[model samples]
Target: MHQLRTRPARRLVQLYAGLVLYGLSMALLVRSGLGVMPWDVLHQGLARQLGWSLGTVTIVVGALVLLAWVPLRERPGLGTVSNVVVIGLALDAALAVLPEPSALPIRVALVPLAIGLNAVATAAYIGVHLGPGPRDGLMTGLVRRSGRSVRLVRTSIEVAVVALGWLLGGTLGVATVLYALAIGPLVHALLPRLSVEVPAARAVQPVS
Candidate 1:
């Protein structure tokens, strides 16, 4: 809705690049050995429980979330399906390379970088306007269908998710709190700057 990064190819590049960055950020946050994003907490828990890689769990969960969209009558766009695939592969790839530091200070340092990068990634993907992440779609759908405020719907879902994740042995720490408080503001600030205006559909002209 802002500046036109009008080239379709560029938008495609942005979409995939943003997705990769988003996955890398998630991996970094998890490696910090602190809390992760709300949905990722569940992913991590399931990963541990099922003896699967975190990225594998993430993809499965994403698919299931997409399935939930059916009841809400929400359609999956190219970005949505790509979000389910590219991010998981990218996450696992990053996790393979990122270290698990036992030292507190090193782990602590990753927090800001991970969170900031995640925000940038989120903005980049969302700015292209192809579609929302599955979790985001779920929240928006619930808000529309239930007549609840976005705040209420999002918070309720996150709280429940976090609770389940914690019970299932996922980490929950200050980083989780930091992510919750900061992400919305970060995305809000960055989206406009990153946004690539979509070209309007061309109108049909009458035959001469």
Candidate 2:
């Protein structure tokens, strides 16, 4: 009990770190100017509307999405709620620190590094076991409730978000495609090595 209570704060730290790395990767990806991922597109769109940094927009979006979680009656794991807050803070910090690329040559050079960082971000993502992001969570929940195939549900959600972001002047390019293709595999690959299970008992259990 005592331990579980502490887990959320601890997880917040870990999530903050993860979001920092994720945000850094995203900034690099954006620098490449190749395209942005679905979430990034949305962040960029919101940033434009609000006249804020993309990172700030990220936090705002994440917070808003978290509001939906309360209604779903999904068990709000320590990681899940922490992720809702920390990702945005970390993203804001990372974006402020990482400057935009100044030239096409530099931008092109950032692609591979961006890809690798993105993979690292994926591991960080699942490490917390907070279920999916807000958008993903909504789609997944709908699929489960409706007994629809995950493929169709996921595709529809992705298409809708991408389309909406695009209409809002979000960047869409090779990087977006790259993120769609690569992030999943990277997460699958790294999950085994990086994951940590939550302690079964909050307090240290007595030895039998």
Candidate 3:
């Protein structure tokens, strides 16, 4: 952790930039009128049903999900708490500024671009190694407790969320499926290259 603090400027920039870009990417997808990632599907549904903005729903859901960490014995780091607050704020801000596109071709184009930006943003923040976001931590926690493979746990959770979100009237389409399939590979490829390793002596500190 000390090593993390030692290069505060770089880590902080990476963390905040990644988070801001993540929010912007989400806004892009929403504005494109295409499907979003599973958790965003839930957020969009809840926002629609509750007459709230997507970002408001995201923050609320994130906080609620964080509560599950107690039972899982997961501890939040600076990035974790920042993820809860910053992403939502940035999402709302980006959504406010970005206009929705009407053309089908433009909307379709936006999906892949948004997904790619999302993957890059995800890698940036995660590579900092401060902590996983609340929803991700939940999946990882479940994996640890159940001794299941990450693929199984992640797939199960995503399936449940997508089903529930669809039931609640969230948009589900090819974009959602694309995001699910592409994100894993994108993150996998990016993480190794982007990750900032901690010092060997300070490696004993918990990542989260």
Highest lDDT scorer? 3
TM-score winner between 2 and 3, please give it. Answer: 3
Candidate 2 lDDT, tens digit per residue, 165-202? 78887888888887888777777787666555666554
Whole-model Cα lDDT of every candidate shown, in order: 0.85, 0.67, 0.86
Candidate 3's residue-wise lDDT over 15-48, tens digit each?
A: 8999999999999888888798889888888888
The CA lDDT at 101 in model 3 is 88
Model 1 earns a TM-score of: 0.92
lDDT of 2: 0.67
lDDT at 131 for candidate 3? 76
Best candidate (score: TM-score): 3
Q: List the residue pairs that clash in candidate 2.
A: none
RMSD of 2: 5.1
**lDDT for each residue of candidate 1 in 49-167, tens digit (9 for 90 to 100):** 99999899899999999999999987666778889999999999999998799999999999999999999999888877777888888888888899999899999999999899888
State in Å the error of residue 62, model 2: 1.5
Candidate 3 least-lDDT 10 residues: 199-208
Candidate 3 residue pairs that clash: none
